[model samples]
Target chain A: MEIYNYMGYELIEKIRSKEITIQEVIQQTYERIEETEELLHSFVYLSKERALKRAKNLDAQLKNGKTTGKVLGLPIGVKDLICIKDSPTTCGSKILEEYRPPYNATVIDYLIEREGAISVGRTNMDEFAMGSSTENSSYGPTYNPWDLERVPGGSSGGSSSCVASGQTPISLGSDTGGSIRCPAAYCGIVGIKPTYGRVSRYGLVSYANSLDQIGPLGRCVYDVALILEIIAGYDPLDSTTVDIGVDEYTKELNRSIEKKTLGIPKEFFGEGLQKDVKEKVKKSINKLEGLGANVVDLSFPHLEYTIPTYYLIAMSEASSNLERYDGLRYGKMSDDLKGDVYEVFSRTRGERFGSEVRRRIILGTYTLSAGYYDMFYIKALKVRTLIKKDFQNAFEQCDAIVCPTMPTTAFKIGELVDDPLQMYLMDVLTCPVNLAGLPGLSIPCDYDNKGLPIGFQIIGNYFDEKTILNIGYQLEQELNIYRKIPPLTIRGN
Target chain B: MSKKEELSKETIEHISKLALLDLTEEEKEKLSKQLGDILNYFKKLDDLDTTNVKPTTHPIDGLKNVFREDIPGESLSNEEATKNAQHKKDGYFKAPRILKE
Candidate 1:
């Protein structure tokens, strides 16, 4: 059996039952990585030695009849933005190319200590989780496994691509405005952006503090739920985390969503949406309606303002959060420069940061600057409240909302890179969920004529991830769209 | 498109300086045009009357200042903290001199 092709949950069960040694799984994971890494360019760093060592130790523990933790030796890929102690956490930028964290992220601690999962490698991403396409990575763009010339949606493109190509059955990605869902949609995988603060951001390199979240990507909703169950909860280290008890997400995966009301926000289906994508998503919503769900036409009047509101707020926060990278502590530092402190600051930042990062910083600085504060920053914030209220009002009549994850399927690499506005619009459908701090799940609904995958997004009320996961799980069982491996993975074997 | 409003080169330079970013002459020209386009697009917000709405700085509602007990816990040693530093002196990060002699 090709163990790499098994879902994360199945692999764990197999290891727990002693059907396969943990070493065998680890070996197969690396072999799969080797098979597809050249084409996909999914990972920035691979911890083969560490993963092998941990697998061997876990194998010994199992033989000694010791009870392993929940995951029981499942290998997971982590987005490079999340720090793992002593591992390179580049966040896909040249600025911190050699920087390693002194401490692991709270999620990494939970995965290793509480759940017994091994992080196989650091997946590639947009520099500091900034762009829609992985094209912004200083390392290079991660290609979609479906078609090498096309991009894997980003900034979590590497995480989604790794899972889709069978390199790892599960991985973690951050969503700060559709980073997680976009990649999952384009790569034909399942990804969840849990409620903001549902997972700790202590180790996540912040792009925008208020909008960022760490979540899971997997081959199926069940696998995504399992990882979410292990990672979701409050952490004292992150004061923003809500002090609420985490529900057993996996327990509710098989629950029925019968008689539930799903609101299809009419604004999302309007102009610029691809015909094929719109049709596919509508069919999925219809499937839910057939499953005893009441589909209602809901309007979020503030939908058009989401891109500007989200970008203004996110960029403003990012400017503040990124002030720490001044080259004085932990990152690339310049030498042989004869300049004062201010000159050093400008030179270091200008040399190290990429064009996108510099652009956002300047824009953010201008918005928050003296003469324009109220006209730009404050106005954007007020519109943000209106956007949030739109969701609140819509949720009053529905259990969840549905939309196409992206307006269209993944485009060819470099197709939209030059046009930043076109690139920003790619997140139009996904960013509203982040703007309101709600939970969103992206699942493969159908494939386009080019064999590229189309994703359907389910947006749930704040802290209501279970309901959406339940809805996704039911649809997943019926659609069974995730069963097809990307042609690259099949060819590799 | 009617005459679009543009951000001046002076404003871009000032903002870049505030952001501690040094832009090349070419980058400044390119960025000024891009920023002008983006900000012009954002002018759509002017259409809404937000007089009664309160700005939302944080997404979560009803969050107050979280106070933790003043307790000591494990902390990073100086060496561990400075391990990634490119320039360090006497357990401190060495930065370019701020005061000119």
Candidate 2:
């Protein structure tokens, strides 16, 4: 049996049936990692010895007639931003490169307790989850498995790359703008940004607190659904976590989209979108309509401002959130302190932060500074409310909003390296959901002529992830676009 | 798209100081140019009317007490916390003394 080609659900079945031991699965995963990691550069830290130890414990439990939960013995790749006890959670920043977390994140606890999931390792990410492509990671950029020269998307890029290359069946990523979805789109994997507060964000190492959400990225919708079911719930620890009962997402996998109404927001596909992406999105929509969904034209006039509004709010929050890293409490400190208290702090920060992080921090500080607060930060917040209101009004007319996940397919690595603003613009289609606190899913829709994957994004009303998944599942069954794997073995370039 | 404001080298130094950043002359010039472009972009926001709109801090409404309870939560040991520090001594973060009375 070709183990790497199997989905997480299939692997779970094998474990339950005793056809293969969980340890064997883990060994095979490590074998694949060792074989391909040189070209892929997906992981920042691999906990092979620790992961095998966890797998053995799980195996003993299952042998004794005890099953931890649905995702028993599944190998899960965690993004470095999510704190895992005893493992390094660098968030791809050099300042905290060697810092090992002392506590597991709430989601990590959930995965460990209820699912018995083995956290194989921590994957790389953009520095402090700040950039659009993983190229910004201090370690190195994780290359696209599809085309080695192309980039796997950013922030969550390492996680997405691991899943795409079959190094792990599933992974966890945090979305603060399009960090999760963009990488998923670029890598041709399934990524879901669960409704804000649906998944606890207690130990996520805050990038932008309001925008940051821990979500699942997997090869199949069911796998993502299973992970979400395990990790999402009300946590008093996280007051933003709603008191809503967690839904059985796996059960909703087969939910039909018959008679379902889908809204295609026209503004998403109009300008700045590539022709190839437009064609693929149209084909996917047609395929969805063919599968009994009623596609309608939807308008959110305020959509044009999603990018600007998102940057302002995200940078402002990031500026405040990052202040805690001021040499005294957490992260690194420089030794060149020859000045007063304030000057010492300045010197420490000046030496620690990277260029992009410093840029955002300064911009955010200026916006939040005394005289400019009302002009930049406050106005952006007002616009954010209007953006949410736009989605609320649109959802009232349609069940979900469908659009292209990104303007174009994955651009070549180093293409936008010099232009920070241009790279930021790639997240234009995705930031609105975070602004509105809505749920969105990015699924593989089609591939461009070059065989690079194109993704279609479906956003739902707050806490309506099941409906979005249902539509995605329906389309998945009809189109089956994920069957085409990129020809990485042949080119080897 | 309005009148482009050229930031003086001295003003760049001042902003960098306020931002707690120590930049070289070359870095200062490059950043000053990039920051000027970004600040100009933000100027576009001036056209919007935010007459009485309250700034939205947390995305969710009624965001109160998002902190986890302090019930013997796991914390980093002094050793672990100071392990990544460039300089440390005796399980504590070491820094140059600041106050000279």
Best by DockQ: 1
The TM-scores, one per candidate, come to 0.98, 0.94
True contacts kept of each: 0.83, 0.48
State the lDDT of candidate 1 residue by residue for A1-493, as single tens digits: 6976799999999999989999999998999899889989999999999999999998998899885589988999999999999999999988897999999999999988677899999999999999988999999899999988888999999999999999999999999999999999999999999998899999999999889999999999999998898889989899999989988888998887889999988999999999999998899988988888998899989999999898988888888878888878888866646789888988888988989999889888888888778888899889999999999999999999989999999898889877777788888899989988999999999988788899999999989999999999999998987767898632211
Off by over 4 Å in 1: A489-493, B1-4
lDDT tens per residue, model 2, A195-222: 9999999889999988889999998788
Q: Tell me each candidate's RMSD, in Å, in order.
A: 2.1, 2.4
Clash pairs of candidate 1?
Answer: none
